[model samples]
Target chain A: MSRQNFEEQLDGLHRQLMSMGTLVEEAIHKAIKSLVERDRELAMEVMKNDQLINQMEHEIESGCFRTIALQQPVGGDLRRLGTMLKIVTDLERMGDHAVAIAKTTTRLMAEPYVKPLIDIPLMADHVKAMVRDSLNAYIAKDDQAAGRIAAQDDVVDKLYAKIFRDLIEVMSKQEHTINQGTHLLLVAQYLERIADHVTNICEWVIYMTSGQKTDLNK
Target chain B: MSRQNFEEQLDGLHRQLMSMGTLVEEAIHKAIKSLVERDRELAMEVMKNDQLINQMEHEIESGCFRTIALQQPVGGDLRRLGTMLKIVTDLERMGDHAVAIAKTTTRLMAEPYVKPLIDIPLMADHVKAMVRDSLNAYIAKDDQAAGRIAAQDDVVDKLYAKIFRDLIEVMSKQEHTINQGTHLLLVAQYLERIADHVTNICEWVIYMTSGQKTDLNK
Candidate 1:
């Protein structure tokens, strides 16, 4: 294959990966919304759509392998393919975390509000932005952009700390809120981890561009 | 490098990877035990050991790349090295999850327990077994052993469900149990995740040996 065709193929794979990212990010948002709104139908929708996300992950893996075997990708191209493979694995996992959160929401629908879920959706918003920016950085090959997204992860981490503290206080005050409060805390943690994964992807983009590993959070 | 030398180096790399896995498994067990026993010192130890785990991950990645480049490994050797690299990444993340749990335990030290933490420790024991058995299977190339460990992950999942339900009851009965209950719940979720990762490593092992990707959970 000519260089142009190879470049185009790589671009196509990246586009597919972005699509997968978009689907997962949407699933996460919708899943959380389903839980907050007590919409069983939306929760079911997220669960059913999980198969599509899984299939996309498989397809992206195949594309990476094909690129490796056919193009014999080396240097930056090699790193890009490999990084995408790793990043997508993280993305698929983030989708699973969202599903888990949605399931918890379904169970808690009958319970009274221990507290308002203000922080969780806020954290989700940050996580989604990180996921979007990480992919955009990869496609743009903009390490600066990736680094900025990674830096924002610390904010998510701090937000987790606050959410955790507040949940503990709520549980301490109302013993009945313990079970539901724990589930809410877990949801925040899942979102925080998704953000961490996004930051890891951004780190990979930096590695791909500069051939040096640096933790953007520091 | 001569073929014999390359083989020896590959074997050494595998041995080192297994040793790293051993260290991580021990850290996870110690972390959970510290929590169950409320041993702050043990929790601190787990925190300190996490740095070594991160270092091992970096070392393994570099070693794999060197082996691939220097030996130009092909066929089975290449696949083995590739799988090791991926498994190490999962192992490293598992270590991080353990640390996350340990941190939660330490934070909950000042708080009161909602219950005896029976299910939390039970869940941790199962996850620790999964890590050990999965690594052993990888080292022995025993697909049956790996499959058994993968199948056992449901035990942890079931335990998590029970624990979550119990904690919810505790919270509802006593408003004050919320903070401690939530932290304990996070610890449980972390263990569940560690088991999931162990199962993932087993899947990779299956792929490595049989050149087939089969979901052992099914």
Candidate 2:
């Protein structure tokens, strides 16, 4: 393939990745919305849309493989392709977590929440921003932006810890709260994990830009 | 690089992956042992050894990148290298889940038995088997074996559901068990996630051998 052709293909893959990122962000949003509002239909929609994200991941993956094989890209070009592969995997996993949140919503649909959902949405907002920023960093190859995004994980962690303690307290005091409380705990955990995936994306962006594998998750 | 040299390099990378897999398996064992026996030292060991797994992932990743760049491998060789890159990621994640389990163990070290740790260890046994078999499928390029291993995930899921219910029941009956119960629930969740990663490996193995993307997770 010509250099121009290869560059175009790479650009196309980036566009697909961005689209996939958008879908993932929406999934997270809708999953949390479904939970906070007790909207089963929205939850199901998030679950259904996860298939679209998975399909996009497979398509981008095939493109990456084809470009690498045909162009035989070296150094920076190869790193970019490899990073794209990893990014899609992260995005796909984020989509899966969103679906997990949706599933939790479904499981708790018939019953009232143990408590009014507050910190969980806050956790979701932080993760959504991390997701958006991580993708932007990937496109710009901004390692500094990636570093900043990773640092935001600390906030998500703190929110999760607070939510965990609060839920444990509620569940202990009320026998009926234990079931829904545990499910809520898992939801918070899923968001925290989504944040962790953002960090992985940040790490990959750093690797793609500077060729250094930094443990930004630490 | 000559063909023989490239083959040798690939073999070395595979050896490194297997060793990483071995470390992951051990980490899972020790993490559960720590939880079951309330062995804080064992939990600490699992946390420390995770660094070794992370280091191995980086080394094998670099080796795979170098081989792909130097050899410009096409067809099966390229697919094999790509699979190795992904396999290491899955293994590294399984290591992280083990570490999460170890962290849970550390948090609950002061607590007495909420129930015997029977089901959690049983879940771990299933996931550990999935890990070992997934790697064997990769080495043999056995898509059929991959399919079989993916089938095993059903067992893990059922086990997780059982554990979830059991823990919820115990916590509801005994309010004091709430904190430790939640942690044990997460421990079971970490094991379930490890099995999911094993399914991911199986999917990659099938893709490597047959050039098809399969959603074995469903």
- lDDT winner: 2
Q: If you assessed candidate 2 against the hidden native complex, which CAPRI class would it receive?
A: high
Q: Over the stretch A1-218, how does candidate 2's per-residue lDDT look in tens digits?
A: 89999999999999999999999999999999999999999999999999999999999999999999999999999999999988899999999999999999999988887668989999999999999999999999999999999999999999999999999888878889888999999999999999999999999999999999998876
lDDT by residue (tens digit), candidate 1, B2-108? 99988788788878888888888888888888888898999999988888887787777667666665676655666676678778879988988878878887888
- lDDT for residue A205 in candidate 1, whole number 0-100: 86
TM-score of 2: 0.99
lDDT of 2 by residue, B113-169 (tens): 966889899989889988999998998899999999999999999999999999888
Q: Please report how far candidate 2 places residue A164 from its true position, in Å.
A: 0.3
TM-score of chain A of each: 0.96, 0.98
Residue B46 lDDT, candidate 1, scale 0-100 = 93
Q: lDDT of all the models against the reference?
A: 0.80, 0.93
List candidate 1 stretches off by more than 4 Å.
Answer: A112-116, A216-218, B1-6, B70-78, B111-118, B216-218
